[model samples]
Target chain A: EAGVVQSPRYKIIEKKQPVAFWCNPISGHNTLYWYRQNLGQGPELLIRYENEEAVDDSQLPKDRFSAERLKGVDSTLKIQPAELGDSAVYLCASSSWDGYSGANVLTFGAGSRLTVL
Target chain B: AQTVTQSQPEMSVQEAETVTLSCTYDTSESDYYLFWYKQPPSRQMILVIRQEAYKQQNATENRFSVNFQKAAKSFSLKISDSQLGDAAMYFCALGEYGNKLVFGAGTILRVKS
Candidate 1:
């Protein structure tokens, strides 16, 4: 079984530039998530998708951050006109949502590191 | 809503020794789960162990075990016979069914050989 996969393991961009990160979750998983991790910090959920529909995204910065998970198989997170504060690692995770009995255990991808200069 | 806290910014333990990392969380929901995840320099979050809130017995996996205090909302991880590979940033998380998992700021663990 393949783990969650993310692209552009590293990214460098200037402030005000647009940056996007991609994620492909494990097969058969119904729930996908996008998280951001600042330096020396844990990952924070920016958005979560249950089969293509975003169920939770209150934490996302709607002003410049947008995310989409088309067809529920893969996801993409974008930060438009990025700021220095947006310099962080974008992580993607997935889990099998088995109704109420679900463990909600998440499997994560090797995040895309974004460096805004 | 849930919030997880890892007060320890960093911890150090010698290889082959034991170490405990402390975590506390706040949640109004009765049915939820707690987790400990390890992130090395590789940047991928790996599940270390997890505990169901309703379960009285703590969760254990290999050399890792959790001391779950429901009343105190404390979940501490004990790593026995630590190895160099154990060096990583450890995060504590709380999750309810069909809800997003809330994470702590994380504690950096250094294993000295």
Candidate 2:
């Protein structure tokens, strides 16, 4: 039983550059999520995907942030022309959609730390 | 809109002692889920414990337990016989079916010898 997997555990980029983070959810999980966490703060959801379709993405900065869950198994979060304030840890999580029965315990990845200078 | 609040920014307790972290959330939904996640230096979010809104009994896991007050919308985590390994940033979150989570500002716990 492998947990959620993320790549580039650490990333460093300059402001105005483009950066992307990747996530591979647990096998058979139907729901995926992307979250951002700033220093001293909790993780905030940027987007959510039910399978391959994005069900919620209101918190994402559409101007500079874009996300895709092509096959729903793996997802990508991108931030182009990044800003200094964008420096934070990007976390990905997944859960079964049986939330109604209280089966939505999320399993999270180690997260990708993005440092925008 | 639902919101979660963690009043304590940081807390410390000696090993083998007990400590409680406070959290409060606002939500209109009658049925929801509350969670306590621990993020250590490794940066992985680990579920410490969770409580369902409809459940009256508090949720307990190993040495971690929660005090859920539905009427007051308060959820607090109590770590019994705390260990140095318990040091981490603890986040309180609220979510309902098909809805995104609303998280608190988080409380950092420091376990001292």
Candidate 3:
């Protein structure tokens, strides 16, 4: 079984430029998530998708950050006009199901390291 | 709102020895899941162990185990006979019905020879 896959393992961009990260979750997984992790800090959820529908995006920065999970198999997180503070690791994870049971285990990708100059 | 806290920013232990990393959380909900993830230099989040809120026996996986104190809202990871390969950043995370995770600041473990 293949694990979660992410592209552009590392990215570098200027402060005012636009950057996007992509994620392809494990096969048959129904839930997908996007998280941001700063140096020395754990990951914080930015958005969640349940089969192509964004069910939670309260933590996403509406002004500069946007995400989409079209078809629910893959996801993209975009940050336009990036800021220096946006330099961090963007991680994507997926789970098989929700609620009780199903092991509820999350398989995470290697993450895309975004460095905003 | 739910929050997870990792009191120790860093910890070190001699090879073959034991070390424990502390974690605490605040939540009003009764049903949830707690997880310990180890991220090495490779940056992959590896699931070391997990515990369900309703379980009392605790969760153990080989050299890794969790001490889950439900009343105190504390979940600590104990690594027995630590190895150099265990050097990594360990994160404590919480999740409910929707698969949304709330993570703590994380603890860095250094294994000494």
Candidate 4:
């Protein structure tokens, strides 16, 4: 089975430039999440989507960062006028609850590494 | 608020030896989930193991196992017969039922041959 897929495994951009990351979640998964991981740190949740609706996005920086999951399958996270502190790995994960077991396991993608100069 | 802590920033284990990575979390919710994720040079987040809060028995997967202490709010991972492939950044994460995950800074595991 195919896992969650992300494009542009590595990206380097100058400060104040616009950048975007794409993610294609696993088929049949209803929950998609975007996380940012700094060097030597664990991932921090930026946003979470349930189908076409974003259920949790309180951590997202509305001033510059924006995300959308239009079709409920693929998602895109954008950072306008990116700053030097925006350098980190953007990870995408998907999960679904098993009706019987009630277990929700997250499957992660390779992640997009963004280096802002 | 929920927070996970990994006191050891780095640890090493000789090949074929056993090593334990310690983790502690603070959460008000009694029923939640704990996870151990491994990230190698490839930078992929791989799920190593998971422990349900209500489960009394510890979780074990192959050479990897978890010692879950509910009252102590501690979850530790034990890797037996460590191999070079096991060297990576190990992260401890906590999540409540139908909630977002809270992660620690992570611990670097180094396996010496």
Candidate 5:
């Protein structure tokens, strides 16, 4: 059983450029989340997807940031006209309920580190 | 809204010693979940341990354990026999089913050999 997989472990982009990160969640997991972690800070949720539907994305910057989970298995997060402040580690996590445990535990991937110059 | 706080920005402990990391959370939801995640230099977030809000018993995994105080809204992680491998950034998070995590600022733990 593979864990949540994210591609491009590290990315570098100039300001005003466009960048994207990809994530492939664990098999049979229905809930997926994208979070941004700045240096010395904890991860902040940017969006959440339940299958093909984005149930929560209020924290997402609508102007420049966009995300999609087309077939419900993989997800893509894009940042157009990236700014220096947008540089951070983008983390993807997935979780599901196991009947035995009443809690939903999440497994995270090796995040994509984005550096915007 | 849920918020998690970790007052310590960084901590250090000698190898083979014990260390305790403190965390406080504010949430109205009673039946939620709390977690401790470790991110090493590799940048992969790993689950260290978790405690269910409704469970009165503290959660223990090997040398890692959690002191969960539901009434006080405090969840602390105690690492016994701390090794060099335990050095990392530890984050305290709170979440519920169908919701995303609310994480603390994180504490960087340093192990001195």
Candidate 6:
């Protein structure tokens, strides 16, 4: 009954530097998602992956942010040339739902806090 | 585009008292789900309670319960006998069938002993 696991609970970087966040979802989970939370704000979806395919990623910043899920289990989100505004918490979540049952219950992991100077 | 709103930025509740967190959402989809998530200082989002739009019964879990008004598109969380552990940032989120969850700005709850 292990929950989703995320790495580097904290990260500090300077502007223009590249940073990456990792996520290991719960076992047997079919859907994975990445969210970004700014200070004093709720989380916003950045991308979602069903197995090896990214089903939704409309909110991801294509110019500097990219994500990948290999083997349909673990995922990695990368931000190149990070900006000062990139300082935020990156959250990872997983769900057992297949996106058809009219229920999408997600379990989240301890987010990675990124600080860009 | 749908949106979730939490007018209260912060609230305080005395220990052993009751407090209600208000949330309102805009969704055209008739069938959807509402959720309350608690984020502690650890930065983990934990599901507190959820209510399905189609269900008439409000969801209740331990000291947590939700008053869901589908017609009015309002979902509020009520914490009875609030404990110090209840202090955190609470987020109201909405999810449609097979769609992303829309989250509000969140409300910070302070518990005074």
lDDT of each: 0.92, 0.92, 0.91, 0.94, 0.94, 0.94
Deviation in Å, model 6, residue A7 alpha carbon: 0.8
Ranking by DockQ: 5, 1, 6, 2, 4, 3
lDDT of 4 by residue, B14-64 (tens): 999999999999999978889999999766999999988989999999999
lDDT tens digits by residue: candidate 2, B1-113? 89999999999999999999999999999999999999898769898998989889999999999999999999999999999999999999999867887789999899999
Residue-wise C-alpha lDDT for candidate 5, range A22-105, written one tens digit per residue:
999999999999999998899999999999999999999999999999999999999999999999999999988856667878
Worst 10 residues of 6 chain B by lDDT: B41-50
Better of 3 and 5 by TM-score: 5
- The number of the candidate with the highest DockQ is 5
Provide the clash count, candidate 6: 0
State every prediction's TM-score relative to the real structure: 0.96, 0.97, 0.96, 0.98, 0.98, 0.97
Candidate 2 TM-score to native: 0.97
Could you tell me which residue pairs clash in candidate 3? none
C-alpha lDDT (0 to 100) for residue A94 of candidate 4: 96
* CAPRI tier of model 6: medium
Where is model 2 more than 4 Å wrong at Cα?
A: A98-100
Model 5 lDDT per residue over B29-113, tens place: 8789999999998669999999888789999999999999998999999999999999999999999766788999999999999
For model 5 the local lDDT of residue B2 reads: 92
State the iRMSD of every prediction, in order shown: 1.3, 1.4, 1.5, 1.2, 1.0, 1.4
Q: Give the poorly placed runs of model 4, Cα more than 4 Å off.
A: none
RMSD of 6: 1.4
Per-residue lDDT, model 2, residue B80, is 99
Clashing pairs in 4: none
Error of 2 at B53 (Å): 0.7
Encode model 1's per-residue lDDT on A53-110: one tens digit a residue: 9998989999999999888798889999899999988999999864655578899999
Candidate 4 or 1, higher DockQ: 1
